[model samples]
Target: MKSRSQDTAIHALGIDFVELSADRVVMSMAVGPSTHQPAGILHGGASVLLAETAASIASEINIAEKNKYAAVGLEINANHLRSKRDGMVTATATPIHIGRRTMVWDIRITDESDQLICISRCTVAIVEKR
Candidate 1:
């Protein structure tokens, strides 16, 4: 499988893929200075980035023709459930709805101890490549 972590936000944020499939995508990012807010906690924006990346990648995998279609993020929302200081945070994204033009994904980010850190929903739009 081609790696998705090249010259993208995923690469900039240090996100590592744990699993990838049409139905689900799992990725991990370490909580460090790069991902930390000024308050020294994991930045909520970073969590949202992880969520949208997973959803967009999953939607792309569902596309019938990679050369003809592309998946782009249409909308995304994240709810921070908990805060983490340091360690790894893993994001798991699963499809809520897969459609002809749009795919919705539910993403949950959890800490190393399996505690929920954030929950997000992302809508990906499939567009014809021009």
Candidate 2:
């Protein structure tokens, strides 16, 4: 996998990659004031960001021509299954479809006890870098 840019949302949100493979990717994020909503629970938008970021990175890893191609998020939808006050949430992304033009990934966000917090499906488009 390539190094993540320092100024991106992933960095800003403190998302850390836990595992990386050809077929799956795992990432973790802290849930606190930074990711909390008005009620002090984990924000749905933050969960979506974690899912999409993991999916996008997984798609980028699958790209053979890194210099000529880039992976970008095409569409994403996430269901907030549960709410958390403060802790760590882990997201696991597995590919549903890996095609030439687009890749679909299923991402599941879990809490510390492995309970589902959010479920997401993300479509990533492989486009020319330029």
Best by lDDT: 2
The reply for model 1, stretches above 4 Å from the true place, is 1-4
Q: After superposing candidate 2, which stretches have Cα over 4 Å from the reference?
A: 1-3
Residue 69 shift from truth in candidate 1, angstroms:
0.6
TM-score of the candidate numbered 1? Answer: 0.95
- What digit string (tens of lDDT, one per residue) describes model 2 on residues 1-130? 6565587888889999899997999999999999999999999999999999999999999998989999999999998989999999999999999998899999999999999999999999999998
Per-residue accuracy of model 1 over 27-81 as CA lDDT, tens digit each: 9999999999999999999999989989988998899888999999999999999
* RMSD of candidates 1 onward, in order: 1.7, 1.9
Give candidate 2's error at residue 99 in angstroms. 0.6
TM-score of 2: 0.96
- Model 1: ten consecutive residues of lowest lDDT: 1-10
Which window of ten consecutive residues has the lowest lDDT sum in model 2? 1-10
CA lDDT of every candidate: 0.93, 0.94
Collision count for each candidate, in order: 0, 0
TM values, all candidates? 0.95, 0.96
Clashing residue pairs found in predicted model 1: none
